[model samples]
Target: MIKHYCGIFGIYNHVEAARMAYFGLYALQHRGQESAGIVTWDGQKLREHRGMGLVPDVFNERHLGKELKGNIAVGHIRYSTTGASLIRNAQPFLVRFKGMEIAIAHNGNLTNTVELRDELERKGSIFQTSIDSEVFVHLIAHNMNGKTVEEAVMAACKRVKGAYSLIILANDKLIAMRDPHGMRPLALGRLAGSPVLASETCAFDLMEAEFIRPLDPGEMLVIEGNSVKSYSLLDEGKKPPTRQCIFELVYFARPDSIVFGEDVYQCRKEMGRQLAIESAPDVDFIMPFPDSGIYCAVGFAQQSGLPYEHAMIRNHYVGRTFIQPSQDMRDFGVQVKINPVKSMIRGKRICIVDDSIVRGTTIRTRVKKLRELGAKEVHFRVSCPPIKHPCFYGIDFSSKGELIAANHSISEIERFIGLDSLHYLSIDGLLRSVSHPEKYCLACFNGDYPIPCAGGGCSRACLEVTD
Candidate 1:
């Protein structure tokens, strides 16, 4: 599985704000797993609790129902994309300056983090964490001389350039903003007339909130009580074309969520349909590796008139971290994660459909297992085009060297993975499955980066951070 970035949720003027934020974060747990935090603004003061673990592990009834009492609350779930994974880097990063308190939960990576950090350090701004997100706090604080929180945030947005979906709790006001390019996903919702914000619509589903539309590119909303005020983070002439991350639909977001006005499940299913139309091999049955490939494989089965079966049963209890056995154990890790259904695989020509193959190692091991299970032929089909380039805007993609597709040919990858035959969805087929294809970022597939970085993803070498 790919590494996740972060997820943010906020609600204003709600009686159970912290509890609601907790549920929102729980729905968005897929977006981050390293740490979870929540900060609230009670009438007199701000209270916060942060811990390094899943949402349920970090928060209990005592922490949510009693300690975090407030009408306004902001929460964060983090898997570090910029800094090291440390408890100190846990978010809803709250700070007090000039008697004004502001807490921020950021969802995307900034491109110019190194440059901005240097400038801020020279100006005598002491940094508390080694994260790029902290740069936003410093920038907002620096611009808070005689301006409102919204104004300070807009000024800060102008100085930095990159993808960011932000939820900020400033004193009694709850504010939300998205970068001009719309490189990340953030949606606005409402629950019993109380305004709320989250990284995905799935959070609204869990909170039983009404999904109001997604925030427009570069739009900023400041909410207090039940009233909401909106503003643009950038001037009209300065706004660039929208470059929404397509990977959000391809892999990052949950199928139940609505992202960028598209139903994620339908989008992925259509991708499978397009793949079947482009290339459908003759096989006894089609199956997925479970979870990630399940939806796409369904569409492929329907379009190809092929029977679908669950060839591999995933061990639902498998945790992200597991104990290892001796090197003498063959394929112990893969076997524990998923075991082949030998009754369904004996002498069958099986076609496996997956989302995307990042590194060929994992798929290679699984394919070898299928052969040992008495499968006649193992053919692989991918629903998305080959990922030939690294992603710079938030996604923690492997470098060119590690990305199998970036350095190997289609035939080479097929041989390396021990597949009888392999095929990937064409770029044209992938674009056909989504709306406004021109507006989506295909940089990872086509190598046409919308925003230039320091090369090999966001350069973190200059920053004094360790992972």
Candidate 2:
């Protein structure tokens, strides 16, 4: 498991549904960057093509337009949690099962997968992926004996635990479901006559789809023929308290998206303001790392009465260089991904706002660029608190040792990132940014995991892997 395990998107009843799904996947590409895939349904057939690159790299007219068909389509970008990080684990895992052609795209990791998988093995079910998600099919196969697909889904979900937001294709109906705790984000969108479902609302914004509210905690959704039905999976007293990940606002979700009724952009702004209050940095200008840090930087600059500037401009076309699996790739990745705007920050006492420092490799490189560009002083302002624990719900914080903040204090991190000062937003302020401040999860930042961490390492509790 890495960080966040890719985003899932689907579009229905549109002329260019596949392309729309591609755009949706593009908006959510941050969730997972390992690989990307899309599956579309023509009235009579299913068409899909995927590869080991970004969404644009995987899809094009020659490859996407001709091979992809259908009014309904599902898309996924992979960030494998427990299984092999290979083409096979790259989802939307499509298979013909139970006399129905099913394509399943999932976000989040399932606990109790091993037990469920052993049960399927006992029933003669052959395995495919190392993903906990694939165990879901086996659960449905072995446990779903109900009359309708919805009933079968409800039946299968009853057996599982931990965070999961999923979309299942069963012939005519497209089903989307979220774990009772709602650990991951899933939203339903509408475009003209089409109905869509995405891991984030940013997908809807990309296609001009009207953003709909998040699926209720413990809600089951069935989308078919441009309409949707929702039902709660738990009784009133049995509800799992809502714990949407706080990192979504700080790092994961696109700024344009809304989750749990909070605007990601606004939430980030609030985070920066809080970071300002937490760190109370003495600086000349508030600067952002660009892309993810813009919103938080805005809050920092406004609250601190410091001007905000882009000290570094990211080359969007560049592949995620640090995401490379090898040393050559990693070094080359940092080499190619960013270009410092020296003129914008040649000589300033800068307080740079960022989301969080994971491995600290990327931020260290970024700070080096700022220092090299002749900045007199560079201070790091992180919008979220220090991350000491790995995430098990869905994100791939696989190892505690890899985290810079896990073993070091703010002063130590300042030395590592080569900053004159380093400040992180307080956990309390981060929670305050959410629209419903009390409802979201802050396990990664605070180490107070709402759900169980399962075990120490990623192999046994595989989804917790963070590096």
Question: Model 1: per-residue lDDT, tens digit, 1-467?
Answer: 67668899999999999999999999999999999999999987889999998999999999988999998999999887544789989998999988889999998877778888889999999998887788999999999999988899999998887788999999999899999999899999999989989999999998789999999889999997657999998776888889999888888899999998889999899988898998899999999988889888988999999999998999999876689878988789888989998899889999999999998888999999888889999999999999998776777773677689999999999899999899999999988999888888888999987777644345436333311
lDDT of each: 0.88, 0.78
Candidate 2, run of 10 with poorest lDDT: 458-467
**Model 2: per-residue Cα lDDT over 371-462, one tens digit each:** 87788898888888888877767666656887888989878888888989887777777777777877887777777666663343334445
The global Cα lDDT (0 to 1) of model 2 is 0.78
lDDT of 1 at 138: 95
TM-score of each: 0.97, 0.90
TM-score of 2: 0.90
Best-performing candidate as measured by lDDT: 1
* TM-score (C-alpha, index-matched) for candidate 1: 0.97
Point out where model 2 deviates above 4 Å: 43-45, 62-66, 81-83, 225-227, 320-335, 343-347, 372-374, 453-461, 464-467
